[model samples]
Target: MNLLLVVAAVLAYTVSAQQCSTPRVRSEWSQLTQEQKGLYVRAIAALAAKPASNQYANPDIMGWHDFVITHAREAYWAHGNAQFYPYHRAMMWQFEQAMIATGIWPSNMGVPYFDWPAMSQNWWTSDLFTEQYLGNMNSNDPDHCVLTGPFAKGKYQVAFDVDNRRAITSGDTTCLRRNAVQAAGDDATAIANSMNAGSFAQFTSSTSGSYYDTTNYHSTGHFIFGGEGGDMSNASVSPNDPIFWLHHGYVDKYWWRWQNQCEQFLYDYSGTLMSANDPNGNGIDAKASADQYTASWPFKVQQLLNTQGGDPLCYTYSKSAGDIPLAPLTCPPVVKPSVAPTTAPPATATGGAAATSASRQGSQLDDKWLYTALNLLVKQKPLGSWGNAPKTGATAAGGIQAADAGDVVVFGRRDLNETESFNGTLEVASATVQADETITGTIAATIQATATVMATTSAAVSEPIKKEQNAYIETINPDNSTTISYTLSNNTIEIPAGFTVYSVMPISATAINETSGKPKRFFPEIPKLEYVQHAEAPVNVEVGSHPCHLAYPILLPESYIESMGMNYNKYFNAHVRSKMQIDAFNADNCTTMFSPSSMMNFNSL
Candidate 1:
């Protein structure tokens, strides 16, 4: 049979029992009174609270569709025939319940149910399901058409996409039906196989295996449809897919569990995608992208992760006890070195002569030195300037050790005297030292100062005989002649010369006195020097011999300017040739330079 006919046949078979009753319409469901919603809430709660043993203990739990049938049967049994309805009717009733609870009263809810035959003859045909499905797809507004009322309203409508191939609002009925069939098929297989496969332990262990490996829609979508192959060809895929509600219930359950378990998990949920939209049709993303969606059933995912039976979410046929807790995994501790010391070292020689006398014999020094040495060797330094050895009696072999300089220390010090006076002169022990001199010995220098004795002659004691003032005359050096007009006052010297001046010497007193005594101020003993040359200027000289012909300026070769014309001519010729080739190719006058012609030729060859 063709795909559509096959789908029609399946739908017909599925709804055959309730063929006389009018199909429940979501619009009609929205008009139910408040009393109906309360009743629904209670019924659903009671149904949720029912023990698994009361529901799936029979030998017939086979496929996902069958499981769903079994669950509906349980709900029927719990609520009685008056309180329940056929698949479509029950959904309509629930919608009413949700509407009343949400304070929305759609106009169609109060309309009485018309017989299927009568309704089919009316303006609204029994094919309302098909029409609605097709209409929702073409509307390009899945959230508005599919998730119309309270139960599926609010944030829940956000993720719905009319354009999605897998979306309910997408008009691809074939794919949807196929998906439903596959889902129902899988659930049915898992259920039927689990029955013959011994206890719940065997079934759960096998089914739960590798389930968490992927987060793809297919992996999750399978469960969403039902345990096995769900019937997607039906218009009631949303409410008819019994597994959807159960799975979501469990998601809610996990939320409650997370509240008690993962402390950090508590917060406003957020994400890039929204579960629903507002009236203006804008997305409402989650508050936190990492927020987890959990099942709302009485049992948690943690409880279900290792469990196959006994929990509220599991069927009673499951044989395992669900109360046992799983063992938690932990990491190992890290280890570090301890602070202790243990050994001693051999004695070393004392200082040489003139040094304070020190005994080198068997002196009982603490093992502090050994600890200190080990620390210094390891950390590469002493603990402080005062050089802390280990505690007094700590033996090198005892493991008690001093900290190295790099080792952190906690101590304090205060300056006792800031200005205790002491004077000493520094002297060089030896001269012409190639390397830097390292003074090792201690020294103490003494300094004494006295006024010079003045002769007090009896020659009329001439006005206290003040010392004759002395002065010197200096001549400028040849090199320094450029700076002849410089000035010297006190110790400060000034030179206006652009170049740097190295050193200057003072004239001798005897030379100055002789110069002053002579009429022309001549000093014969003094050197007749010009400017002192501090350093010699560098000489620039060319090396190697040049060809005689190349050396003569008059016979020099043509300059670079002459070569320029030749270069330009070569460049212009190349450009002209390229332009000619391009123009020929453009004109289709020649095919050699064109890629299309070349490719054609190559192919032919």
Candidate 2:
């Protein structure tokens, strides 16, 4: 016999004076007076808005769902708390209404009916809500409700007969009350179990089969029920399935109940679930995992569950009919603060201070050399581009440009204002001597590079260039004993050998305020150089006319010289092809202009 047929047969055997209730449209129509009905409605609404991903969709949350379902079933059977039945019934009705309101259900689709026995079977098959129930029941064969009964092997067996009807209409008063108490006990156990298994950590990794992968009804169903399941977009779903809402309402009910039972639970409400990208959909803040609920909402799950018909949280309801309101129920007061403030500073501060001090002291070595090194590092480790190519001999831009060699290029003057006490300088100059002439130039004559200091009071500090004396550079070359010199004036630094210079200006300076006496600072124009072959004239006296070789000094501004330090060739190569294409290359086929071997040769040069 079919499992459904067997369960139906058993259901027919038990008859009650009270009929299964219909859902109420408004709060006043419920059998339980008006107030209890209001509480039920509020609880349902709270469950609808549960944090679908984090604590709710967790396996622990699923366990709670099962526990709640089991208890609700148990309560219905044992004491016929009729009150609890209406809450769930009303919840289902509201959920269906929402589905209709949101157009999730077809227009022609009549309202779904809730057959508790069928629902019980559905829960038994679900991966998210079956663990606890499975432990006590025989799920392999739906015909048998008993795990170890004589009739377990056949359909319409006696095992199903006992469990389906014993608690509901049994004359034994002790058994009837025990059922309700046991149901509550199961609920408590599930909550404790769920609390112990906090936050789902699976979403943090790169695993492909997580619950975040789909947006189908199954996934949505799991989300509402707080169960563990894959994305719902599986191809096997049908159009007229009734299990979706039954499962979702149960899930929602758990959240509602959890809100009431645990103060910590209400404060911890958060949304960290991933959903399909929809522009108008609620955005999931991954960092919100750390945030806790603090705002006072109009209703909370806890107060809704506990309030009676006369209280502000109350509403009336009956299992045979929907909700009725006796008095108007007001929303619950919002909880203010969720997180606790620190009484003392964290221990990491001391460690961080030591690290910072060490770094600053290390940076104080010759600023030019340090700048050059940082420029190289920056070039090799470019995070993003700085826009259009810089023009030659332009004003010094104030942003630092790093090189692949960990060198930094700084451009500008090198003097400090009276308010600031730093005055650092690097001076260089050169003089040429003919082959037969005596070398008669002092070291001071070689000091041809100079940087002037300027101070500014401005609001925009990131404009890229500021008039501060922060860098200097000079170059000198000897060609057949003739010296060629490259120099810089007050606002610029000559670029050294094998360097490319770029300038950045600061947006504005913060040290210069309205009350400060300093004028607004501006960067001076910078000169850039490119090395070209320079040939010396032929000397007629020696042999026929031997060509004299000449070596010209290349003068680059401070910023351009710093660009030579870093090696960014590797980073440039990495982004050229897909990962598969890169993996496909071998020593033979991979010999291209930008290949690893060629890049190494370029770096060496």
Candidate 3:
């Protein structure tokens, strides 16, 4: 009995130690009381007015601008990679502390999120655009400068344009600019797709999107809120906008929701530190860990993972309209779609141009295609031997290539700032075509390539193309929570349900936002692509179809990967491609460009 009492005392002490005394609740903008909202805004103004603290260490900057500079300096490390979530989580907590320091808000008052999807359909008409809230949309302004509201032009002086490094260092000042626009990527389906990811590596990749991919909710949210020429659009200096805190608060809440789904996910952190767009010459694509320090923040990544774990992060997100669990769906086996067989057309010499259709089957391509057609001519080898090309003339091994492909005109999807559709071109002087059977036995056709063929293709075909079926079906629940379902790995995922069902959905209603009573004039007129209409994943394994290709050297050999005690199949499958293509290439006797054995040259890649 004495021993039991001693053990009970220790347990009680542990429980007491772990309990948080002043846990805060981060709410949606609509959820905040009028007084709370006023205080929140006042705190922001007060914080902006205060001088930068010595701890922040930015010379001649306001307290608020210090956060902006911190974010800008560490932007490269914070975005397009695994550090995205944890780094922002830490930044959010620090911003909260700074706001609390203003004395206008209560010590435990947490940041509020703009539940973007909830009001996304009618964001322009929402109370968020009022002078009392974030600011006016300023849709009519040529420069997209905020014209009225608390953050309108001249209301607050921006320290510098983060886009220009010199401007940042020189501390150039300007009025806030917000070219607010809507994006298909910032919808309920996109949010659901990201939240449904079963693993952290998948979650991070899907949620953040790759450096080359900007269709995901994270990138879209920024683009929509940041508008065309706004502070929020710039990843590095996004903190310049006060709304950045709220946006990140929503992101943290999403992470928190993902964390609560399972015990394993709470501290689950694994992904490469190097993003696809590696800017810093970081040779090591190091695996990310919770133990690592967050970008620009003093806290460790693990500490930032937990919201109620105290000291730095001690807040709970108020349950809002779209709050839902990450449902672990077990889908039924997939029935492979039968490809209709087509007889090869007879080679005819009756026309000025040969009409041919080449289809690419997979996402990753072998790098051997980097060689010029002259190289193939010198070797007198069929183009199919080099890469996944056809064995014939203009019809063979010919299709649009990605902009990054050597010496070719860069086209298709580009970074947000890029305006040019065509960059340059590759000129192949003269090439003789060889076909199995031709009208004249061995037809010698002279081919001259000038412009990027990819440029002439439709946007859907030029950029990453998504099969029509993978799109999410969003059902608005009677309770206001969204039931978004999508297919991943043959598993049809309907969040909150234990089972799965296959679905092919049309794009969600784009007109829902327009139905609101707001006059048409109130909305922003900024033009942008509808990513919702073109969400991408695994590519169709049609030769000459896709532009994005992974060089062979990047893939670790199956034997070597297995030797390290990792699943080689999982590593390969982890790439954003369909399982069918990955499976086909992994098999022996496959005669595709993705020859794993021949391509595995780690020694001299």
Candidate 4:
């Protein structure tokens, strides 16, 4: 079945097709004029009154809303993994096409996208929810159903979670339920991180994870708005929410922004190629492309990849600037240390948060003076391994004894403060120097600035930056350039040979000063893996949610076989191919779709 859709799409976008230039701009709901909003409502009403295609079991589609419900039913396979962006883009376009077909939509009007990230704080409560628009939260119904909306109870009866559930093999109708959830999931820093991610792999790795934090962009919106059992929470039926279209608009906009960053991003396709095995022997199984995606219109992943092409999806975003907050990174220049004035050489840059204090007794102090040349990697000062230490330095830190006992302090011949000149005792430390109060609340603000910038909603560093236990505190060098610390083990940690523990990198003074120079939003990057603490519990969405007749997926009518005078079972592949071509060939009336014998719903004659 997937191949059928791909073939249709390949034929639809012939080489001669015009590249979209005067593309319509999709804007926020609040930004729309009264006329536009009214057209949407009217179009919706017309679609509702139109007969439900009966492609699936529910014959009571009340109008265009059923298309939205049909999409909600298929929500299971729409998200998670990679095709999420492309799959949904195709789906929304189909929904728009349905509205347009009903003649309710204005010629220039495209589906409006809600710019959640771009809105001022507490956007859900905005005027976009007015009775003239999508309506407000229900005061009488505990499910938070919408009241006073055009689709209100008598105005429009819902059949599933909102209007229905995924499996609608029987009778089930309900009112539209909505709880406008205040989403603070993606803050400026996190969204900025996602937008600036270096590669698609990096972007995918970071965004699709299970970690629901303040930085997540796509899924977090669902979790934030879709409170327990709310229609938006369940992927199988999230489409029940009217605002779903708008939210996906923002998502599609993000893809557009990322794609326009560079031409190479146009072909950047990762994740799975084929979505599921075709239930229809005709080989029409769903692909990551468009078929079951939204009416399964002949749109492939590549066609939607770039919105500029005139191929069916020819819309553009009015505002390319993502609502994401910008957080800039600045790495300062490195400064070399001057030699010691006294006989003692510069103290080695020690390891742990707070390095051990200078030795008090002369013999122990002499032993401390013994040091070995440090091994350096391109980025880190590798304090992991060490060799024989030879006696070198003589001078000792002038600081008094009785340092914090519980704390590990590194005392050397001399340490250098940002202000103080080097060659003497410097109180240098690793994470703890920055960890005492830098808890989970502060973790998102401090991801490593230098690592591969994958925009992950990684569940890794989900835990707050509380005090890490059983970590290593090494006092390796005497130079104050930088210090390295490691996470040794947990309470049950058993150190294995050759196992490199997690490293803690302290920021350099120059870098710190450079970050502090401007607006003073200092984000020092930590270990990349350190951010991903765990894996999210995977939820595999079912292929087909409910029973259907036509087997056209979302495209064909039930009587396609008898009315077209063909044995659908005998030449299923050929029949499907012809139907696809016929649908595109005749954009209006969808005549070939409706078989006179198959038409049973009262809405359609």
lDDT, candidate 3, equals 0.44
lDDT string, candidate 3, 105-212, tens digits: 786567888776544344456677778877876556655666777777667766443324222222335566676664222333225445555667766643221221
Which number leads on TM-score?
3
| Per-residue alpha-carbon lDDT of candidate 2 for residues 1-605, written as tens digits (9 for 90 to 100) | 13332222122212211221222222112123344433333333333323221111111111112222222222211111112222333334323333333323332222322222112112233321222211222233222122322112221111111112222232321110110000000111111222221321221111111111111111223222211111111111101012334443433333333344434433333222211011111111222232211111111122223223111122222121111111222233455334333232122212232232221111112232223222222322221111123322211222221122211111122121111111111210111111332222332232222211111111222333322233222222221111112122233222222221211111101111112111121122322222222133222122112121111111112221112111122112221221112122222222432233432322221
Q: What is the lDDT of candidate 4?
A: 0.38
Better-scoring candidate (lDDT), 1 or 4: 4
Candidate 4 lDDT for residue 359: 12
The models' CA-based lDDT, in order, is 0.21, 0.22, 0.44, 0.38
Candidate 1 residue spans exceeding 4 A from truth: 1-218, 221-240, 268-271, 274-605
> Each model's TM-score, in the order given?
0.18, 0.20, 0.49, 0.46
Candidate 4, residue 117: how far the Cα is off, in Å: 2.0
Candidate 3, which segments miss by more than 4 Å at Cα?
A: 1-22, 57-62, 139-142, 162-172, 182-185, 206-215, 275-285, 324-326, 329-605
Give the residue spans of candidate 2 off by over 4 A.
Answer: 1-192, 195-239, 271-278, 281-285, 288-605
The local lDDT score (0 to 100) that residue 320 gets in candidate 1 is 15
Clashes of each: 56, 96, 12, 61
lDDT of 1 by residue, 1-605 (tens): 12332222222212211121222232122233556444433433333223322111111111222223323222211111111112222222222233232223332232122111111112122222232221111122332232322222221211111112123444333222222211111111111111222221221121110111111111223232322222221112332322243233322222222222323222212222111111011112212121111111111122222111111111111111111121232212322223233223332323231011111011122243222222222322112111113222212111112332122221111011111111111111111111332222221111010001001110123232222111212222332211211122222122221112111222101000111110001111212223222133112111112111000001111221111111222223322332232222223322322133332322221
As for TM-score, the candidate ahead, 1 or 2, is: 2
Please give the range of 10 consecutive residues that has the lowest summed lDDT in model 3.
Answer: 354-363
Candidate closer to the true structure by lDDT (higher is better), 1 or 2: 2
- Local error of candidate 1 at 385, Å? 82
